[model samples]
Target: MPDYKHFPLADTAEGLTEAEIIDWKVKPGDEVTVNQIVVEVETAKAAVELPIPWAGVVTELLVEPGQTVEVGTPILTVDVDPQGAAAVNGSGSAASAVSAETTETAEAAEADADEMKPLVGYGSKTTVAKRRARKSQATPAAPAPEPVQAVTVVAPRPASEQAAPAGYVPLAKPPVRKLAKELGIDLRTVAGSAEGGVITREDVRRAADGTAETASAAPQPVTAEYDPATRERRVPIRGVRKATANAMVGSAFTAPHVTEFLTIDVTPMMELRQKLKGAPQFSGVKLTPLVIAAKAVCLAARRTPDVNAVWDESSGEIVYKDYVHLGIAAATPRGLVVPKVRDADRKSLAELAGDIGELTAVARDGKTPPEAMLNGTFTITNVGVFGVDTGTPIINPGESAILALGAIRDMPWVVDGELAVRKVMQLSLSFDHRVIDGQQGSQFLADVGELLADPAVAITY
Candidate 1:
């Protein structure tokens, strides 16, 4: 018998450095064909199904669900046989034999095996990273076709006879799938109302909304493995989350930070905002203080370029950026993420507002691409939305400074030697102490303040 070789993880769709394994469609020794959806991966962008690249027996699952693996991490192994015998004899009883003696191991080891079986080091149990590439014979076989079943419904049929009428399609719609997920309903057991016994979206919705019970009958729970709880449940950090955790730890420990704060009267900016609300170009756009604040930061960055520079510790150099890739801190379903807007300084006020609106919408929907979150030159976090008045914000790694804009509210101000009501806001700027001196930080904050205080000055610059 010829000894086989190991296959390292390949770059799945672009150069996405990492992905979390969401679910495995195949296990060790399962025979799979080409283009068959073998695994589900959650990249930073969306949940995607990974089709098998080659036809063969699934030798092993390299990565476990929940682990955030780098782009080139070996996700699984396949025993490809250009000769064809391996697909038939090699997978049949041999697979069943392996399954009979299932190995129970430590969770970490199990996770390693599930994600990617690590290359074992000499005289040690620890797994070691290896080089990445693809095998010439790694192309998988064709997928099996769906079997057709026939159904006959008549008066007083057996329950199982009523169960799967020959060729009965699962009665459910996409929205019903979404609702079923939320309400813990099983659609497979629910009978359909559409032609040819196909399930309609309304059928699933009715069952999920508990309104179907008022009509004909409620669906009995399908004992099929499609348990809503089993479909998805939280797994504490193994896949993408673990990978993100490691990267964050690495960035945090390597970067040093410093922060400063300033209070300013933003009555003028507010007035300008009200005026923009009536503008033809800015019509239908959601113009908020953050939009103006973004503009102020961009304008201020033009005068003070150091605030937008990225510190490259590897090269022992400070990089002064010519363009602003403004990062907006957004809270997402997965975690806290900062997605950047490219060339933010060049965008018009209305364009900036639109881009901000779209990017925020994408982030909230958990559909933001990984590339959108990369290469940020500066970051602004709006704590005001959460009703936070002031906070010392931690600088986003690589970028020299992070600006925290607090709630703009009414406060007493001195005007012409008399107290007057005014709209005021607290701004906190945190920077890398090694890069930004206290004077530079203070001046930057003041520049931002001046723009917000008198919006007209922005035109002069």
Candidate 2:
């Protein structure tokens, strides 16, 4: 007889509540090996591929693609017995007996499976169902008043004037008609380019432009159609975007945030970055300002440990970290994700660059594992890449501080009593005021700025 088992959604390190079934790798009756990736699920953090723990033949797919299932929900069922097929094919009477026994066993097994513990952790707590009181039937509402119809009167026109000329109606696709309508262009007045005198998008655009030019010469009152489709769009927030939103809200309201800004001349850091790019040790590694800033953060955190600590409200204590798990905030197609570089304080500059590169690549590919994002001691968000000057960034949940790197631009600076052009950058530091005081936060920000201003300062620190 075949031994049946169910596979439930496991709790990943991110503590995901639900995930959408992005894909199913196996169908019913397909043989799957132990530890084989059987399905891909899109959780709030990333797309995770789940593997089966035991080899078996897939009996049924409990969930379909595009369905969002709660954690601990059964996703699939499988049969572990491979020799049951041979036994059934051997003898007719024996086969019938085994079939009846298997039916009973399967029914009992399914019932037991319902109470089975989930593969990852404890199952959801059982809730007692309470009977709701029946609501009294409502009385029928009074009939609504009839709406008044408006009538219009117009003088009759001659048939020649009322009717349009034959083939005068503009030939155009539905989209073209809609476009013309939106542009307030009368199709009858515009010329068509197609063989059948059908209007194309280009023709409509040209006509609209001409109309704009004509109107520019002499302004006229124009009436435009309101298109709700173009006015607004609604996207369901469920995955990474949803998680980020929740975390940000929680962090903002729960933590007393204090942000400080500093503008620094980072010419030396930029020069060092370019030099590293050409070095053999830094070959194949992306040497960006963020890498230097991240290293600076680690060094600065060592001097001011409060910036790397977390506030424990339940225990009424501050948890200061001795080591650093530096998180680099990367904006992916899905959403913003911060994957940590483990033991960042211990890694060399080149090692940090490589780790940042790998983490960013995995995040961009939407393949970052949930575990890689947890337990971050500090976070750095490079808003500079987007050309942003500076932003008051929110601290990531459980972390005391977050640093935002701004765009590097050429600006005039007074150097040695003379004005000259130099690379300038802005830094914004946001920290939990409860764990990090204004003095400590300011010191940390100044240290980072100093390191960026003069890379040699990092060696002394």
Candidate 3:
């Protein structure tokens, strides 16, 4: 009579359909409290820690680490009343708990809603439950597993889809089955490299490529010590990396990009930075060229409002904004994330530097929230930190423009008609041609260059 509750996976971010389990904070037999961090999941935007809402003893972890599951799928089971007399008598069945949970899901499905919403919870939900397909590999000699409902990820297609001869079902995961179907590779003909003769996605791909060894349509014992999985390291593209790739691809293909470069002597800006570092007001603030460039972009945007506008395809209009949500492109070990500083134009130089420091630190730790990454009007990516010269940057989809700040090199520049070695940096501005005119783009670049070339010029703006 253990009061067990099957805890389903909840949507961690907006429009998030699925997440990959990174790690579990607790296991079976461990005690947990309400709102205690239970698992780490990698969503499309970031890595997030999810907390359990129900306090209980961890009975079972249904999902394994590195496995991706759609939102609302049950991930863990908790015995809510673990100390109950019936629970202590060891009468509670996890299978019974699953049956009850599945019943609840079936009841919810009978509702009027056609399109299911992801049960929201990482910050805000329960689930749209879909019972996972079971792993249908047969092992007549092996002992039967316990009668607990387990998340089965290995089988998706029925035996009829595998083209096997006379009552044979190929062992393959859902993704592998889909891949095999697309590539027209018969899973029954391909030899599985995985343990228990389970075919992998790579095996199906190799068979399609003609690189896999041809074997008779018969199951064979895996005798070789070498694991084909170890032949190459496969990093699953999930979280930020996957989202960034998709976003960049969309931006690059959808928007007509025009890039303009401007190289300027930042000797004046550097000198001002040094002087400000000594000032009491600027104490503890690490003001770099990028900070000045950000400020310059804000000031310049006032003169060229088109750079801070969005080209709305649905509305067929150019949407102008009075405020700037400046996106600072931060590169973490995971991938590139452009988290925005809300109302960046209104912030002072010192405020901008501090906000960026905290924002980037959170991003580097892979903790930037989904809302922090949205609603950016303009983006500034400091490639200079990587010691890279300027390259054309892609517009951040909805926004019109992006600025790439390059390395600050000590180069010879003509100063007052005299050649002098000074700190010079290049700025590359890429804009959506549909939103920003060539003249406006040039004017914005010139304004930013002028501000960096002479710090006093900001008084006029």
Candidate 4:
């Protein structure tokens, strides 16, 4: 009998534990070539195309698209050998023997295709098992997933009192939980007032205020100890999330991040934006402060080319790129992604707006290709969309700086040495100190601020 080997999920370059099958390029019964992309998997970081290492017909698809698979799971099966037709009188002709030999050769080639890489601590070479590896493949004795902690928004009752029957701990976001922990409040002791039995940040604050009652409940012993889950979410980190995570981590630690803030009176720019709204060219396009900020960054890059260069560790030099690949930080359902606009410096205002719109649309739809997410020269993150005033944005890896555009609101400002009301906004620039010094960074930021303060300055730039 010929060996029918199953193709297990391999370790993608990124160390991801599980990946969701976004799409399957090949189907059952399809003859696949070695190293051919057969499936697209989405990790938390990005979506990557998985290539088949063996050449054979796909006998069975073990998992369907949108299904998550753990690393080392057998995703599909391929039959290396097909049965030869029955011979008359139990006798085979000369041509049949030759054809069987050819089939044997093909089967042999298929078997030879998948050469298992050795696992450490094993005394001898062991081939990967034909069956899919369980979630506990690495450590078989691990326990199941832990139960979710319940949140109670009401205050702790007297020593003898107990919680309401339906008062279970509520679910809250990680950041909200962090806040509660910082305030030294137990999540379970507080009664969740948010939707769907979820704990809100406000609920935690209300508990801290000492005015809220603990939903007629006593302080119960913390019985929930989190268990080590054998169940893992293995994502083949290949796409935008993967790229963005790598970039953010690299930029955060390596870059001596020095963020400088400048609050500007943008009353004139707002007037200009309003005037441009009536123009025929600005029709149908979303005219926001982000568009102006993008143009500003482009103008600033022209003034300071060093801001748009990558630090080449291998060459021990900085590689200054002539063209600008402006990365716009977009938050999608999957994760944070920075898709670039190629030659953004050369594009007209309308063209840049159109490209930015299209890039964001594609990224949100999860249709943006892998290559478009790479090789960014600089990044712009608009925190204003989230109603944030300012943030020290991390530089995207390979780039020297990132500009954060803050919320634009009407505020009291000193105009011509007098306190007056104006449309005030802030610009926060985070730069890699290794490449950009305080003076250079300040200049670049000032140039950007100037452009935003006066839109007509872009014509000269």
Per-candidate Cα lDDT values, in order, are 0.64, 0.75, 0.76, 0.67
Candidate 3 Cα RMSD (Å):
9.8
lDDT agreement of model 2 with the native: 0.75
lDDT of 2 by residue, 415-439 (tens): 8899999999999999999988899
User: What range of 10 consecutive residues in model 2 has the weakest lDDT sum?
Assistant: 146-155
Instruction: Give the per-residue lDDT of model 4 (tens digit) for 343-457.
Output: 9988877777778888888878765665677788999999988989999998887888899999988899887899998888999999888888889899999998888888888
In candidate 2, stretches whose alpha carbon ends up further than 4 angstroms from where it belongs are 85-231
Off by over 4 Å in 3: 85-234
Q: How accurate is candidate 4 locally (lDDT)?
A: 0.67
Clashing pairs in 2: none
Q: What is the TM-score of each candidate against the true structure?
A: 0.57, 0.72, 0.72, 0.60
Backbone clashes, candidate 2: 0
In angstroms, the error of model 1 at 432 is 1.2
Q: In candidate 4, how many clashes are counted?
A: 25
Tens-place lDDT digits, model 1, residues 86-161: 3223323433222221221111222322333222211112444332222223223433221111111111223543
Off by over 4 Å in 4: 1-20, 23-39, 43-45, 48-58, 62-246
Off by over 4 Å in 1: 1-18, 23-40, 43-235, 238-252
Which 10-residue window of candidate 1 scores lowest in summed lDDT? 146-155
Question: Per-residue lDDT tens digits of candidate 3, residues 339-413?
Answer: 998999999999998888888999999988777888899999999999998999988878999999999999999
